[model samples]
Target: MDSEKAVPGDGVVVRAIRAGEWGQARRLRLEALRDPVAELAFLESYEAAAAKPDAHWREWTAGAAEGTRDRQQFIAETAGGEWVGSVTVLLERAGTVDPFGGTVACDQGHVVGVFVGPAYRGDGAGVTRALFDAALEWAWAADVERVRLYVHERNTRAEAFYRKAGFVASGVRATGPAGVGGFELEYEMKRSA
Candidate 1:
């Protein structure tokens, strides 16, 4: 599902990222890492992400881009062609281990790497909403039992948005993705019966 939001003059469209757009993916990720709340919003630090080589980006982007079996990244870009935001969904098969070493009790989509450029944040958060809409649609299409995301304890703003997007707390707490002291609360949208 492609969504259009009134951000730029001509508006922005949300769609799955492509493999050849690795450069845009890398640059957009760096931009996201620079956001003020990025420390709590993302798992990796700016320095760590920026230090990755072009090859790392190419391979990573390729894996997360459309055509991959396990993941898909949906990005929002203006009609003028500037990327505004992105949200990626990763499929975790039941009986497998997740990135955090937790057992995946069921097939699910784990949403991550959510971001909207500063210019397109807040009142213009339509970009973010559109991004999530696309990401969630993709997850549901993949027939996951549910879609979940982890948010930092102190990141109230992000948690609010996730709630608004229909995800509710799962009563599970785990170490933040960075392996830091803070806890990351799990939020999920279980598939309707």
Candidate 2:
């Protein structure tokens, strides 16, 4: 599914990231990690991501770009070709273990790495909405029964956006690891299809 926002003149189009565009993906990810809210919004640190080698990015993009069933990343870009935002979805199957060390009891899509540039935030543009719509549509197309995402309790902006997008709290809470600072509350959101 195409990830074009309905509002014209925004010049932002969301689409599946290409494997060869790993450089663009890496740049956007590094920028996301540098956001002021990165500590609460992402699990990885900018230093850690920046330390990774180019080979790592190549492999990362190959696995998450379009055509990969286990994972996919959608990028929001401008007409002039700047990547302004991105979101990735990971397929979790029944009985498998997730990154947070939780058991997946059903076929679902796990949303992660959600971000929009500071200059492009808010509803007036819809860049974030377009990226999310693409991710959810991709998951549903793969017969995923549900789509889930975890947000830090401190990230009210993301939580509010998820709520607006039809993702309800699943009443699940988990303690984050040392990588995410000590003992942060993580809330789970499930798409209400």
Candidate 3:
């Protein structure tokens, strides 16, 4: 399905991720994870993400796009069809436990793995805003009451962007594993009536 949003720059398209775009997704993901600030945003290392098998990529992309019972992924592509950014929203089920240690409430959606290529960043192409809009629309369509994302405490740029997109900090902090030595800041955006 093509859900287009008005981005600041010309010829930008925001839509659901394609089914067989695993190769492209994998490539873009690696590029994003290689960014200087990646350590604060993404959990997987470039080595780990790059080493995944084709089957893994296929499953990851497919599951992320169409979404399973739990997760969904979306992409923002330029008019020329280059992927400029991406976002994934994971649904937390009621009565079920989450890996982040919160009992699921109101079928919340957790946004993660958000990244925009450096060339596209700060250009106000609307890639980041478009991605968030699309993800929240999907979550609300799926009957989720609210959407949330965890930003690393050090990732001020991402926090600023999220704030611009109408997300407010819930004042919740979660610590990463010892080696990472960072705290995650949780931000949430609620579905509008």
Candidate 4:
């Protein structure tokens, strides 16, 4: 349970989703889906997300509530109890076919659903970095060879953030379902020795 904590003095606590916090999770996700750049930054739409039943969110949250190795969701909450951001990391085993129709040649942590509220963005607020730090920490501890994430080709802000976080373009591209509408760019960070 204590495995989740952000660096000090940021006024935000980074932790895994709790079983009963699904409603909050649902709210934050819907909010993220409504962002101006959501079409380019997310694979799902606000309408699609809002249509999901409470049970769906509860089940999804339960899986990530315990910090499991297969998948984990890290969230950032303000000292005042507002959920500002989240990141989900999923283990992609070697020899398996990835969601993008590619073979996963190495054990890797595939990062997804990355989002931070616009109010907490930029260098002035450390929320984004804190959430990613927790996510990367979890991925590395799970023994993944690397952590990778996909950004829509037009999502320049996301790509820039990933680059600043030590991730580099892998020269690989993938196209998601029609919801995504276009190709995605892959960026990754290799695990340290």
Candidate 5:
């Protein structure tokens, strides 16, 4: 698969994660889990992620970073070679069950693990946008009908950005386990044929 495409501005380039870069991916994920909004932005806790074995991390990266048709992870890197953000997309097919235990009813892409570091968030940075663009581009190229993501109802920052990026609330609501404040809303953006 072709990788390493440059974003239009700010010298941030979006690229596919390669095999053997599991350590880097793990570090970035742990960093994302440390963000102030991490509790709402991600389902996994920093402690949980930190406790995972190296083999687990490697397998995780290998599955998404290997350019498999089922999923892909894209990262935004600066000119100085720092990874600032990431977004991952998983392609679901009809008849296949999703991580959420829902039966896949159509060919679609589920966007997940989206994040941009504190230093990279702001006007004109474009790290998050670039990462999303790359993932959506991959989804469209694969002919998926739509891309969908679930955002914690309290995470207004992510909701607004997703709306600005053309995603609309699909009226799908999910409640997490009883102790977690239980409310996430699904948003989706469809591909134009």
Candidate 6:
């Protein structure tokens, strides 16, 4: 399905992940997890993520395609049909708390699992930026006051990208499990005035 098309340096389409696109999602996700820097950004291992049941993949893709009370996922595809990048957004309810140890003071969205294949990195075809623009537009259209994401302390590249896209550090740090020591830094971008 044609969701949204972006004319980055090259033509790329940023669209919602369709129902049957689970297999494609699985493939891209595995490829992302295998990237050398995956350990610094993604929480799941390639082996574990690749082994998830088809039902799980179906559910994940369906929710992102149609959107639910809490989540959505969007994909970036090159004109040649190559899956190049992805981003997922999770809505956090007011007064509730998130899994990363933050209380939801206002209705907001959390962007996660952002990745772009190395080939497309730094091209500024606007593929990745367009994905965030679409996601934030959706969240703000839903009356969300802000959108936030957490980046690993070691992921300076991601941190720089987010900042360039208008996010600022929230000065909040979350510690992961012992094996994954080091804090995750919180960054937020509120709807512009």
What candidate 5 gets wrong by more than 4 Å, as runs, is: none
lDDT of 6 by residue, 22-139 (tens): 8999999999999988887888999989789999999888887745556778888888989999998989989897886667899999998999888777745677787787778777
Q: What does candidate 2's lDDT look like per residue over 51-162, in tens digits?
A: 9999999999999987889999999889899999999999999899987788888888989999999988888878888888899899988887788888887788988898
TM-scores of the models, in the order given: 0.92, 0.91, 0.91, 0.94, 0.94, 0.93
Query: How many Å off is the CA of 94 in candidate 1?
Result: 0.3
The Cα error of candidate 4 at residue 162, in Å, is 0.2
Worst 10 residues of 4 by lDDT: 1-10
Candidate lDDT scores, in order, read 0.86, 0.84, 0.82, 0.88, 0.87, 0.84
Instruction: List candidate 4 segments past 4 Å from native.
Output: 176-180
lDDT of 1 by residue, 63-152 (tens): 988767789998888878898898999999999998888899999999999998877777445777778777888888888999999999
Which ten contiguous residues of candidate 3 have the minimum total lDDT? 1-10
Q: Look at candidate 2 and tell me the lDDT of residue 66.
A: 77
lDDT of 3 by residue, 11-106 (tens): 777777766899999988998899998888998899999889999999888887754556778887787888888898888877788767777777
lDDT of 5 by residue, 1-193 (tens): 3588776767888898987889989999999999988888888899999999999988888988856788999998889989889999999887899777889888999999999988778657777787888899999888888899999988999999999889999998888534568688999998886
The residue pairs that clash in candidate 4, if any, are none
How far residue 39's Cα lies from its native spot in candidate 2, in Å, is: 0.5
**CA RMSD for every model?**
2.2, 2.1, 1.9, 1.6, 1.5, 1.9
Candidate 6's C-alpha runs over 4 A off are: 67-69
- Give the per-residue lDDT of model 4 (tens digit) for 69-113: 589998998888899999999999999999887899999999999
Reference-based lDDT, residue 135, model 3:
85
Total backbone clashes of candidate 5, pairs 3 or more residues apart or in separate chains: 0
- Which ranges in model 2 have alpha carbons more than 4 Å from their true place? 3-7, 177-193
